[model samples]
Target: MEEQLQATPICGRHRALNALMAPFGGWDMPIQYEGIIAEHSWCRSSSALFDICHMGEFIFQGDFVADGLEDVFTFSVQTIPLGRSRYGFLLNERGGIVDDLIVFRLAEDKVMIVVNAATAPKDFAVIKERLTGGSFTDITAATGKLDLQGPLSRYVMVEVFGEEVATLPYFRFITLNILGVEAIVSRTGYTGELGYEIFIPADKVGELWDLLLEDERVKPAGLGARDVLRLEVGYSLYGSDIDEETTPLEAGLEGFVNFETTFVGKEALLRQKEQGPPRQKVAFEVNGRRSPRHFYDICSGGENVGMVTSGVFSPMVGKGIGIGFVLPELAVVGTPLTICHERITMEATVCELPFFKDGSVRG
Candidate 1:
């Protein structure tokens, strides 16, 4: 039997706007408000508000080393300074990625861990099993998250919130008063835009959503648009791009892993590094507007070499773009490949990542 889908705090607002609803990560999420392409374009040019309350949040308050929290993830937790966040992964014994997450260092001994909605329960279990002592608690039920992203996001945030938000550098966060409560505003986002991820009390999220949308410069965008934006910037989608069977080296994300640190999967990763990964992730551009879809075969010299994991018709690039795992020899840039699904075949060329490069993410 299929599990019952969960709903976010601003679900009613999405329905009132007549959004196209669909299931995503066990949540009944709005797939699109206007349309995927339209919303995608709007987000690239202006600001787009997103209901991200479906993600999970956890609070860990204790000694990083004594509590055994320091060795749980790929990156060292002690290195992250206060008021800043770092993105990395938790891995299984086989060196496969369990989840890609961000850890916010709220204080010397306190950190907030934000993870994917679908992997929250398992992630908590795994982390808990590894910890010796720490006050670890799941805070997802009490927290609501919303993302404001795009080139004009800074302007809109300053107008709606205040000038203090304007000075926040990338990857930094601040706790500020919003809707009569303390909220965390982080300069972090999935989309390749200058944006902020706001975490407020669940009950006050609806009010904050309304207030943000009240601005003329801000428009509500759903997951459909968010996917396109992230894909254009070559960001990986957890379930599709990386999973328990996939390693960071194969996914071209070895930079996130620190071999110097002792973690659960470090030994396997070191062995894999010495042996080299069998498969490698590749970015490609389709010859035309025919977008590659997940599970589609990646062919080279009429032989199946891999499968597409994520693909989209990008408005910014004016072509179809995709990322997939392919044979190491065939993953080179400028190598011609064929994406095939049943009788349909699309011509493509192996390319470098970030298909759309002129994004306002750093600006």
Candidate 2:
């Protein structure tokens, strides 16, 4: 028998909105509200709200060094100033990425670790085993997260939350009061838009969600739209793009890793740095509107070279864009490639990332 999937506090609300539901990360999540394309467009032009309660949240309170937390990830924890967050990866002993996550420093001796939903349990276990001393606790069940994204998201947040949210820079967060309860509002998002992530008590999330949608400019977007928005910005999905067998170096994400840091996979990364990765990640664009799908073959001169990890027909780009792994020589810009499935085939060219530019993320 299959395990029962979890539901968020706003599941009833999503159903009321006639959302398309599907299983994601062991949870029954909303795949779309009105339609994927419409919602995706709303997020790029106006504002789109997303229910992000399925993701994981953890809290750690204690000595950063004595608890061995300083060396658990690729970047140092002690260096993160208050009200700021840093993105990096947790790697295995072989230098393969375990999970890409963000660390938020809440106070002098307290921090919050946010991770992908599917890997939450394993991430918690791995982190616990690494820490010699710390007050670590998984707060996923009690915590609720919602994301508001798009070019006008900042205006929406300021109107609903407060003016304080208007000035919050990217990757920064602040503790504020909402609905008579303390909450964390972070200027971070996955949609490659000017956005805010609001964290509040699980019971109060539904209320917040309802209040935010009161604005005429804000519409609810589901995971389907979220996936497209993230892909357009070249953000890698944890399980598909980078997994236990993929390293940051090969994924074109080495900038997130600090070579001077003493982390669990330092030696292996050093070795790989000297030896070079066998396969490297590449971004490509199809010649036409034909979309590439996962596991599709990537060929060069009729020779199988790689496989597509993520692909989509981008509304913003007006073409198909994909990310995949291939031989290092074939990962260069302008390189010709053929994407093939059982019968369908399309010509493509290697390209730089962020297939859809002109995002208001930094504005």
Model 2, stretches more than 4 Å misplaced? none
Q: lDDT tens digits, residues 1-363, model 2? A: 896899999999999999999999999999999999999999999999999999999999999999899999999999999999999999999999989999999999999999999999999999999999979999999999999999998888888888998889999999999898989999899989999899999999999999999999999999999999999999999999999999999999999998877999989999989998888999999999999988999999999999999999999999999999999999999999999999999999999988988899987
Model 1 / residue 19 / CA error / Å:
0.8
lDDT of each: 0.94, 0.95
For candidate 1, the lDDT comes to: 0.94
* Tens-digit lDDT string for candidate 1 (52-80): 99999999999999999999999999999
**TM-score, cand. 2 vs. native:** 0.99
Candidate 1 residue 262 Cα shift, in angstroms, is 1.2
Lowest summed lDDT window (length 10), candidate 1: 155-164
Candidate that scores best on lDDT: 2
